[model samples]
Target: MQRYFIAPEQFGEHTVMIDGEDAHHLLKVMRMKAGDEIIVCDGLGKSARAKLTLLQAGQAEADITEWLGASAEPLWKVTVAQSLPKGDKLETVIQKGTEVGAAAFIPFQSDRSIVQYDGKKEEKRRQRWSKIAKEAAEQAHREIIPHIGEVHSWKQLLQRMAEFDLVLFCYEKEGGAAGSGIADAARSFHRSRGESQEASILLVVGPEGGFTSQEAEQALAGGAQLAGLGKRILRTETAALVGLTCLMYESNEMGGA
Candidate 1:
């Protein structure tokens, strides 16, 4: 059965309407017929199994055959507060980050970040990232789309770091510290959360050149524990995905995929 996300408002008693682009895809692209089965989700974790009752121009009606509760969301909520990288990097970050179940993405300008964003450019950046997140979520079969928060300065990032329960700032300083790295930090914190407990993880990854000493120290002072990804360095785009995958896998929450 095909799966599509719809707004909670569109879900009604016994009947549901899926119109617009989705309808067009179902009717034409996917060649869905009247009796075809489809699953509709609210993108906020509610879902229903429906059989197509009617198909028309910009409209596809169905009956609610069954309801699926919030069964698709990740057990851990992760927020990636990444330093703004060079051109096209942010798009990759948002798209892959969404696939890994990040709840939010924070783009910030750090000391080593060469890319500067003025007010106007910053708004456009957010919009583009938002689009990438939406498409990634749909393709990954995610029930909720991760939010792309506005670009921030180092000061603003520190101010917001206190919000998450466990905040981790990827720092090379941990390279010198024995037995304390990103993998270690992630396991140390994630292990404390019993299965089914509601917890949030905030992982901060810097730009192409990585975080400066001052920025890393400040992030630590602001409540984020510092950790190094590993001995071999990674690119800005690679670091986010690598670090996140390690975190999810270590926690056994990647769910066999």
Candidate 2:
């Protein structure tokens, strides 16, 4: 079934009103009419099965049939704090990261980042990134769409480190060393959770040139654990996904073999 993320207010006692882009996609693009069943999510984790009762140009309505219980979200909320990379690599990260169970994304400027920050076009770029996340979430059957944060400077990103329960800094220098791996970190995080089932994690990936020693030291001082992906060096765009996948696997969000 096709899934659509609707606002909470748009949902009635047992009905949901789909409008604007979603409606157009359902009514015209998908050619969905009355009696077609679709899944509706609030993007805040609530979702339900609905049968379309009305379909018109730019508007559609569906009667809720069953509230979904299973969720595609990870037990721990993993936010990807990615440094600006060259070209459109950030877009690829956002799209694939969302599918890999990232709860949010924070794009920041690092010391060795090749792309310079452009404040004038940030909003437009953010909108495009958000759209990519949303589409990826829908395709992956995620209960919530991953959030895209505004571009942050190195200092700004460091200041927000305290917000997360754990921060894993992906540094190339840690490869093949005795440093912490994402699984061990995730396991430690899970053990320390005590009564809480949910925890927030910030996975920081550097740019193409990777994080400098000074930056890595600063991150360690800011309460981040330096971790490695594997023996092979990964592109800046691939690090976030790999780290996120490892975290998910360790948390048992990924199915057992």
- Candidate 2 residue 76 Cα shift, in angstroms, is 0.6
Lowest summed lDDT over 10 consecutive residues: which window, candidate 1?
248-257
The collision pairs in model 1 are none
- lDDT, candidate 2, at 184: 67
- Misplaced by over 4 Å in model 1 are 255-257
How well does each candidate superpose onto the true structure, as a TM-score?
A: 0.91, 0.95
lDDT of 1 by residue, 1-257 (tens): 67787778898898889998889989999999988999888777777899999988899999998887657667778888888888898888889888887888988889889898789777776787877887788788888878788888888888988788898888765774666787787677766775567778888998888888888778878898888877778888888988788777766776522
- The TM-score of candidate 1 is 0.91
Q: Which candidate wins on TM-score?
A: 2
Would you list the C-alpha lDDT of every candidate in the order shown? 0.82, 0.90
